[model samples]
Target: MFSYCADPSVLDGWWWFSCFLTSATHLDFYRAFGAVIALLLVTAPAALAMGMAGAMMLRSQIRPLSMLGRFYVNIVRGVPDIVFFLFVPIALGQGIEYLLHLVNCPDWDQPVRQGNDFLVCRDAKMPPVDAPAWVRNLYAFAMAILAFALVFGAFVANTLHGAMQAVPHAQIETAESYGMTRKQAFRRIVLPQMWLVALPGLSNIWQILIKATPLLFLLGIQDVVYWARELGAQKTSLYSYPHPDWRMWYFSILLVFYLLLTWASERGFSWLTRRLSHGQATAEGERLRRATA
Candidate 1:
């Protein structure tokens, strides 16, 4: 910003643009990008953990356990992500409040549902009625993260399950020859090998996770997209830095932010793939050997 920024009317040329871009709302806009990154950082691992559990369940010998896991993976895949994003939080929130009501006010006989409305005691409210603003925001963010994890976890489970199956039969047979049980063979041979096959799919899922971060705005998170829209909308002439229809430009910045994120992720994955492929039995390992030779 130029010294002349103190006198708004005196600003001209690039000074006007610079001051506008550095405004408080724009600072918030910049921070929103960090928020998106944070969401991905939190959600990706959560989804992976959930997926691993789901996959393990599906692979279990117990019939009910396998059915429960398979049902979760299949049902989630059939539903559109956006629909789950919208529905899950509402359902979870209501379910939580309803459970709380049953525990906190067992003597009260008022019905929770009266036509279109779902009622809960004031004490039953999540974050409570007098929660700090940040608490409410945190609750919403937690819900969004859960929604994203649940949706993406299904895909991750499917990929992981397939990767588990892709492990060579001969490898398992060799392990069996040593008198290894199913669990021992799986742990020593199949589980270790599955990562090589699963990495590419997991990398793709990571990219999808990055792209889905913007949908946090839909769940009322003050994410980057929320700040972009807030700052980019038409500013009234009353504001010190007035702009007309700058939403497109603001969104262009958002686009570049996401582009940089994905690019960084791609580079990181490339390095990881190389690192993971070394000394492996896969094609990448063979190529590395030839290249080194």
Candidate 2:
């Protein structure tokens, strides 16, 4: 952006570097980092909500609902998450478009799936063919978020279910002995204590989630990985800012980004665990009690 940068031929060393970093695409690359952060922030809560629903289903008195919940956790756990990450978005996207096609073009439709090709009317296409670039980006982002939520939600469900079971049955029993209903006991006694038990597993899952964000590139979102590849590609001398293959450097930066993310998350979770464990019946609480005594 400096006057020296006006003639890129004369620019060298740090001057060239400064001008290159100020390019529009480079600015986009910097902004794309926020997309990854946004995905994590949005996906974590969405996954937690889905997991809570799944946990509730697992605990349902209705046999069918419980079986469905257990099946979701078990069957998904069997498949590799990367497989789901790849397949879920394409399938869900086409499924949504297909449904829309059937709704909007009932009279004119040919079969949507003829052999391998998935065909839908133009109007039914997600964001339509005419939609703005940002709309298309938003659509891809939504699909990625859905995929992340579904996969992590299953893991969260399993963790929460186990945590619920680990909560002392005697606590619930005592509540019942005091004339509390099953729901009342769960609300007043079981739920509060289960969180301390769940915290460690949930913290581990959050780290996994942090690492999994790079997969957004595969889902067609313009996330940090996409930007890294774009910016790090070898550039010819004909280009305003020429560089050799810089992917290694770009990815090293990404590694540092994720390292910082996980480290911060770990420190925060550790503090939370300490806070939660301070006055409870868990080992941490016992250790504190002994130390204080």
> How well does each candidate superpose onto the true structure, as a TM-score?
0.93, 0.94
Candidate 2, residues 123-187, lDDT tens digits: the string is 88987899999888888889889999999999999899989999988888999999999999999
Per-residue lDDT of 4 in model 2 = 64
lDDT of each: 0.87, 0.89
- Count: clashes, candidate 2: 0
Number of the top-ranking candidate, with lDDT as the measure: 2
lDDT of 1 by residue, 1-293 (tens): 44556766667678888887787777777777777778888999999999999999989999999999999999999988899999999999999999999988888787999898898888899979999998998899898889999999999998999899899999899999999999999999998889889999999999988888888888878888777777778777644576777779878988898899899999999998898899898899999989999
User: Model 2: what TM-score?
Assistant: 0.94
Could you tell me which 10 consecutive residues in candidate 2 have the lowest summed lDDT?
1-10
Q: Candidate 1 overall Cα lDDT vs. reference?
A: 0.87
TM-score, candidate 1, is 0.93
**Candidate 1: regions farther than 4 A off:** 1-7
